[model samples]
Target: MDSNDFAKFLSRISSTPLRVLDTSIPNSKYIYLDLSYDNSNLEKIDASSSESLSRFVNSHIKLHHALVAFGGYNEIRSIYQRSNHFNINQETERNVHLGIDLWCGTNTPIYAPIDARVHSFKNNKNHGDYGPTIILKHVIKDVLFYTLYGHLSMDSILNLKVGQFFKKGDCIARLGDSDVNGDYPPHLHFQIIKDIESYTGDYPGVCSKNDLDFYLKNCPDPNLILKLA
Candidate 1:
């Protein structure tokens, strides 16, 4: 299926919104966060410091009376400059985020939004990487797609195996801290992939401007499933 058709298929997966976080946490408790370079407020803080970013994220949640601060699909960020993993140079810098991040506390349980089987799992140990990641294969109406969960706890993948089945709402993993989550504040990097290509446990969560169009098509806005306002 084409990207447009794939997005429509995802939208019709369920009559109600999907839940990757706790089901009890109402959608009203989720707030939109702008970490883009355009947010001048970020200039005052050290974006490279995990502690600083954590403080910023937590405070935003508290200030908004929210349980989760989420956004960043297609957002252009400058925080990636802290690690060469995201930026080799100006032209090749992959600063545009391709996923929606749910900023919450570490150890927060993450759930499978729908029925799926483990396709792959890996510990991406590079600086500013996903840390522990899991990709799940989902086939609904015979249209195959994948969902990626990134920045998870070590124990999340300790005994996980490929092809393991998980029913919808199953506890798949928990959020990881800065120590194990690529030195960033605790957050779930959730993405949807139409064509996974040869990618395994990890896929490009961010893309350079030159590749934005292609990546956007392959990885549709995760909100198509989450439906977070």
Candidate 2:
């Protein structure tokens, strides 16, 4: 199937929203967060500092009476400027986020929203990168795809093996703190990939404007399944 068809298939998989976090945490508790350059509120804090960003995010959550701050799919963010990994050049800055980030406290349990088998797992230790990551392969109605979980604790992949199976709602991992999560505040970077190419354990979570069109289609908005609204 094509990208558009795949996205429709994903949305039709479950009428109700799926959960990668605790099923007990209702969707009402998830507040949308905007870290885009257009958000004037970010100027008040040091976006480069993990601690400062954490405080800003937490405050937003508390202000809305929310337990989680979630957003960033296809968002053009300025926080990425602090990392050279994303700003290798001026014209090709990888600032457009490809995943839906769920910002919450560390050690929060992460679950598999659908039946899957481990495709790969790795600890990407680069600054401002996904620290511990796991990619799971899924096939439904004979269409194959993958889901990526990033910023996971070290323990999440210690005993993990390729091809290990996980039923829906199985505890897959826990959130990692900045110490291990690429110097960012605790958050889960969840992405859905229709075609992962030959990548293993890691895929570009952000893309430049020059490549946004391709990335957007290959990595459709994860909310198609999560349906956070």
- The ten-residue window of minimal lDDT in model 1 covers 8-17
Best lDDT goes to which candidate?
2
Candidate 2 C-alpha lDDT tens digits along 1-229? 8888989999999999999999889999999999998999999999999999999999999999999999999999999999998999999999999999999999999999999999999999989999999999999989999999999999999999999999999999999999999999999999999999999999999899999999999999999999997
Estimate every model's Cα lDDT from 0 to 1.
Answer: 0.95, 0.96
Model 2, backbone clash pairs (residues 3+ apart or across chains), number: 0
Tell how far residue 156 is off in model 1, in angstroms: 0.2
Error of 2 at 95 (Å): 0.3
lDDT of 1 by residue, 32-137 (tens): 9999999999999999999999999999999999999999999999999999998888889999999999999999999999999999999999999999999999
Record all residue pairs in model 1 with backbone atoms less than 3 Å apart, i.e. clashing. Answer: none
Point out where model 1 deviates above 4 Å.
none
